[model samples]
Target: MTTRKIVVSALVSALAGGTQLAQATDVFRLEGFGAISRGMGGTAVAHDVGPAGMMTNPATLSLMPDGDQAMIGLDLVTTDIKVTNKATGESVSSDTHSNNRGPYVAPEAAFTKRIGAWSLGVGAFAQGGLGTEYGNGSFLSRATGGLATGLDNSSRLLVLNIPFAASFQVNDKLTVGGSVDAMWQGLNLDLLLGADQVVSLIGANRATGSLVGVLAGIPGLSGAHFSLTKDKFLASGVDAWGYGGKLGMLYKATQDTTLGASYTLKSQMNDMEGGATLTAVTAGGQIPLTGKIKIQDFQMPSHLDLGISHRLTPQWTVAADVSRVFWKDVMKDIKVAFVADAGGDLNILLPQDYKDQTILSLGAAYALNDSLTLRGGLRFASQALRSSTLFAVIPATPRKHLSAGFTYAFSKQAKLDFAYSHAFKETMDNTSLPNTSAPIEVTHAQNNATLNFRYSF
Candidate 1:
């Protein structure tokens, strides 16, 4: 293989591995593209850039310098996630903080070449990922009388995407660009079986299903006999691949204003291999359960974006963007196909009635001197999913973000960029399917920093 191809492959691999250690943020998307865009609230569609523009809007590739340009960026992210279950009969309520994830860094890299009025680029970046782990003792059994008090629950997910793109300068007035991305995703979930569901499946009096075994002496059962329908830790994980693409256009409306628009199609991935396994411990013994997600239509959502950039003065530039994501179809429910079951299929209707969400971004940059530029911006979005569907593993519910950054050009060919962003604390309330006295509450917050090095030929 060529040296360029080798470097590209290595970089993509690195991004995939790094996200395994970071927590979920901004729902499932990063707030911005790179140091430059992050500093200015991730509004890069109408701005000028080289490799960073590949993920934001391929059309911006045409806005780059005439020569070749390359960039590498690193993002350091830290998260605070907490889940609180309300107190109920025989079971004591709990407030647990999930801190197992974070202090992680994700990377992005790209190379762009400009020839005549056309530009070609290839890049890799970590889209988003989340991880959560709750202590075993955090949950108590009011029914089991505390015998099953130890709970092992957690989840992790990551997406690493690679895009090949090209842009054309149709005229001084417009530029168009397009790209197709190969999307790869990994998912891991370790969750406790629902108390109510367990009751329905195994309770001695419920004659609906045949009982293979029962937790005979467990006091938490509240004087009822029950069997294990699911495992204590359901570790269902899979790595899968999919495809998607984007189309964009940049318009020079006037000497001072630039307008941009783009649309991205959804990505569809195959079923997760090795499915998931469930382990149940009982007086009768431990029974193993297994299943795979019925990925009839597992895919990432599609979105549309519109942006504007205006030059107010020789030293000041301002930009704003509005984006909408359609999540209703892809996120409403999850189905699991067990190896064999009398109930036919195990289908869990998720509370994730994720609606079509709208996000707004605004930012400005000032050229302070020959070598320094200062930037700051804000990003805002409403709720993506309803409180009833909120879960501890994926807390993508923050509503506001603040950021600031600067760039230092050491020479004509080299530059260093930095930006820091913070998503304020937000709380989400959820309803558990069975046995909840009150809504379960989840709180989330985040801090992110970006650094990048770029060179121009």
Candidate 2:
């Protein structure tokens, strides 16, 4: 009945029960949204793809054929990850080969209506996320002085987005559009901090930031380490709501060429609140405490995209997009605070130090006949994460991608599209960190497919 009720209902129906583990290209953001865009190398801005435009460049919704349209899409993502923690001088080596939990599915839907010069649309989609799962036998279970807790190591994050968008055809050659976005995000993490990292956080938060006084008060506390683990009973995990907006412009520079640009603002979200099991280890013994955790100041970055679509011939079309993500602004650090029920509080800051990302996508489509079309594309991206700060739990580092797909029309009002993409494998050795003897090496690659069915009445 009311706006607050509407958002709450939407989140419950859309995100309450689902656990998504989708991979990303420009960090935690997907390379593309819809099947058509994925089939053509994540190109969408100027290409009249489909209602998924509500999540990309809403101005393109005006380019859809007249009348009402509805579409549903699904993406299946599979990721391969291998992590190796080796300390040559210390003779400690461990490797987790393909321990990621994946081959996950993401769903999307949209409806759009065109009335005269105005186009209105609404859509929901899985923006993107990252995850990994390592068993209890993994090296991550061991603490300082060879103490083993036998707890698994894992991390999962998912973001779902809803957009209400509108576009206006200002003139024969110009169109503009905007969308207000509602976003829901879920995060689950179980990380084991090494003795050195624990010491670093303690020093950084010494002035009452973390449980400094309590830690300092612990007698016989030497060689300290710890972990913040999610309770086994909490399935959905810590979550929060976020909001942002996007503005887009489309211009028909020529009969055969169209240009498009869009800007998305940074997201504003509250802290993620949830329960966690905090385990603190010391030379004396292991202290297990129950507490509430607040993940603070976690927000998505802003970005700008510019693209062009050109009809080279009656049977062929091509599109190219260049974009930049301002990660340096939002991904500086991740801060978390824990208040224990027993008698203490702890604060931790995880450094990200992500650089701005540059992405280039190029794609081409050709109509083979009246009912069939073929597409292929390539995407290139500059590395966004530095090896020194890259954590094994979140390895979003692929830099190149190749994709192909096809579309088939069953009738004037119905069609099916399918696309598949592969991210090239990459390996990073964390030799840049101070402890080069125990460099963490990660190898990651991905494959994903998108299927969409659309109908118009």
Candidate 3:
């Protein structure tokens, strides 16, 4: 069979499915790819940038400098978040808490080999993942030893994407390409509840409400519900896998102008299967129980990108792109089934109701000379998640980004690329249930930096 046939079959079987890491907490969509792309405010669609461009638009491969090129890079992200707690009638702040999950690193690598008009490449990288760690026994779990005695209140999600890509020049003016990715994700979450929180959840959480309502009529049995929920040890961890494909086209509209478009299919993943350990504090110390938790109806969002780049002169060029993410289809809600060791089975549905989002990126680059080039860009993304549904585990809502960077050559075949971006602080209020509990006010801000090295032969 031909390469096209094999690729089609593999993508159908692999890319159709995808994972369960928590929602990304950074500035949406993995914060613009990397240094080369990030330096231009994530504008890889029309202006090619070696291996970094492979994940954004595979067709750009045909337009790359003719040679075997390899690249390795990392994006270091620092996120600052604060949550306003309202467990009581009054409000108190949780004192600014930075993510306890340290070394927040995103790494990537890619290699390309060109033969005539054909460009073949392979890449491995983290597509996107948002993770955070607040001490497990703190905040909401104050009754159970609060901040000092227990595990941290935290959650994590990681999505790994590997694409095998190929691009071909259709003629002197156009190029097309596609790639299939084997995507997998991992998730871990830990949350504790106090008496007030338990009361609030019993009323707002459909699963807990239904389970507790059964004992309402029985005078002696009703109190048992509160005991089970009070200082409740609630946490779970799981892993999932799936597949997806990306298609792209690049056209040379004029001698100095290039146009590009690309689409990424949503990945369908298997149900998240894992175990949760439940424990409660008693006079005899801590009583523990373990059971299974299955999460279903979860998938990653799909997005479309279009771009245009124009070279104003031999040393200067400008580019712009628009991308839209269909988050509603995949992030509407999460359904989970709890198989317990003793206290009856319960099924819970967590509401997300995420909306679609559009992002605009504009950038320009000027070559200072043969060994150095400078670039800067701006990007804005409309909020996709409603403030009411925004949870602490997923605090990635930011509106504007300012970026600047440069590329310097140390030798003929070796070079370094670096970018820096700062997302203005944004505060999303009432990021919790509207009337049931005190509105959870969440504030987020970030400092993002990336560094990369390229070697061509």
Write the candidate numbers in order of decreasing lDDT.
Answer: 2, 1, 3
Question: 317 in model 2: Cα distance from truth in Å?
Answer: 0.5
Residue 260, model 3: Cα distance from true site in angstroms: 0.6
Candidate maximizing TM-score: 2
Q: What's the residue-level lDDT of 180 in candidate 3?
A: 86
TM-score of each: 0.83, 0.90, 0.82
Off by over 4 Å in 1: 1-24, 88-100, 140-151, 197-236, 281-286, 290-296, 340-349, 434-438
Model 2 CA lDDT for position 421: 95
* Candidate-wise lDDT, in order: 0.68, 0.77, 0.67
lDDT of 1 at 282: 45
For residues 1-457, could you state the per-residue lDDT of candidate 1 as single tens digits? 9644554555556544444334445567777877999899888889875487878789999988888777777888877767766544222221233433346567778788999999998877777676565545654222233345244555656666788999999999999999999887766655554445355433523222222233333433332211111222212256678888999999999999999998888877775544554444443334445444443355777888899999999999999999888877677754333332322233333335678789899999999998999999999987787776566556778879899999999987778899998899898776654322234677788788989877777
lDDT of 3 by residue, 1-457 (tens): 9643443344344323222222243333675665877888778888787776778888998888898877767677776766666544333232223332434566667778899989998876667776555543444334322322253345566677778888999999999988888776666665443333334445666455233443333322211111111121112267677888889999999999999999988987888777775544332344455667677756777889999999999999999999898988888776766666666565655667888888898899999999999999998888887877666656768767888999999877778999988788888866344211345667777777888777777
Misplaced by over 4 Å in model 3 are 1-28, 86-100, 136-138, 143-151, 193-205, 208-236, 279-287, 341-344, 431-436
Between prediction 2 and prediction 3, which has the larger lDDT?
Answer: 2
What would the per-residue lDDT of candidate 2 be over residues 1-457, giving only the tens digit for each residue?
A: 9643443344345433454557776689888988899989898889888888878899999999998777777789888887776663321121232233566678777778899999998878888887677655655556655666566566777778888999999999999999999987777777776565565655655224446666556654433333343433223357889898899999999999999999988989788888777766666676777778888988888999999999999999999999898999989877878888876787767777999999999999999998999999999999999888887778889989999999899987778889999999988867542122246788888899999877765
Task: Evaluate model 1: give its TM-score.
Answer: 0.83
